[model samples]
Target: IRAVGTGQDALGEVTIRVREGSRIVQGKGLSTDVIEASARAYVDVLNRLASGHARSSADSAERELAQGGVARP
Candidate 1:
């Protein structure tokens, strides 16, 4: 969730769900200053996604070279 407002005003917050294994991110901006808040939230989700990708790639490579590796069909 990300939000920007003079906050005590009537501005509503924006909420979004981030998906893994895909880069199609999305969002919404409710208040007049929504752009700033939306950008911040997008960046935060992107950073987390980047880190997850790095970890999964490292793990996959390690398994590829592991001893007695499972044979593929």
Candidate 2:
């Protein structure tokens, strides 16, 4: 977790990476509340994994890289 701004209104950003089988999936969230941001990040990863988005997205990225295209995160 990290802060994106300063003072009392600082935005909290959270990033979480989870390992599923042989792949690693990542999720990010930002909010004025650090805990909320963390929860959002965790839920994002869970949704991706549960919906099989992580696997397909990772496969697509690998294919793009193999074809000499940039793999975006």
Candidate 3:
């Protein structure tokens, strides 16, 4: 993560990058408050990770069920 003062209305520009294996995700946030900008950048990465996990888990579950796997109670 990197942040820089944009020198415009006391705003800040933040760049966030996340890497998982061969997958890479990037996000940018700009705000008059530096903290807010940082938080936004972090949340963006977190949301992406959560979304990927949910999708992958669902796909795996479907594959398992299709292969005659049982769903435990």
Candidate 4:
């Protein structure tokens, strides 16, 4: 978790990354509550990974995101 910025209404931003086979998956979440933001980020990563295939090039991870890797509010 990291600070969003000074004077910002949000509490913090959370970033989560996971390595599946040869690819890397990333997720981010921002919220006024730190714990909630972390959970959001964690869930985001899990969802992305679940919707993705394990076999691919490193750059394919970016492609997956571009193609709309599972997202949630």
lDDT (Cα, tens digit) per residue for candidate 4, span 18-46: 77766666778888888999999888888
All candidates in order of lDDT, best leading: 2, 4, 3, 1
Model 1, position 31, has a per-residue lDDT of 54
RMSD of each: 11.5, 4.6, 12.4, 7.6
Give the clash total for candidate 4.
Answer: 0
TM-score of 2: 0.70
Give the lowest summed-lDDT range of ten residues in model 1. Answer: 19-28
C-alpha lDDT (0 to 100) for residue 34 of candidate 1: 58
Q: Give candidate 4 misplaced runs (Cα > 4 Å).
A: 53-57, 60-73
> TM-scores of all models?
0.37, 0.70, 0.52, 0.61
What lDDT, from 0 to 1, does candidate 1 have?
0.51
* Candidate 2 lDDT by residue in tens digits, 38-60: 99999999998988777555775
Q: Of the candidates shown, which would achieve the greatest lDDT relative to the real structure?
A: 2
Per-residue alpha-carbon lDDT of candidate 3 for residues 4-69, written as tens digits (9 for 90 to 100): 544556667787766665445556677888788888988887887778742344454566589999
Give the Å error, residue 69, model 4: 23
User: Which 10-residue span in candidate 3 carries the lowest summed lDDT?
Assistant: 53-62
What's the distance in Å from true for residue 45, model 3? 0.8
The superposed Cα distance between candidate 2 and the true structure at residue 23, in angstroms, equals 1.5
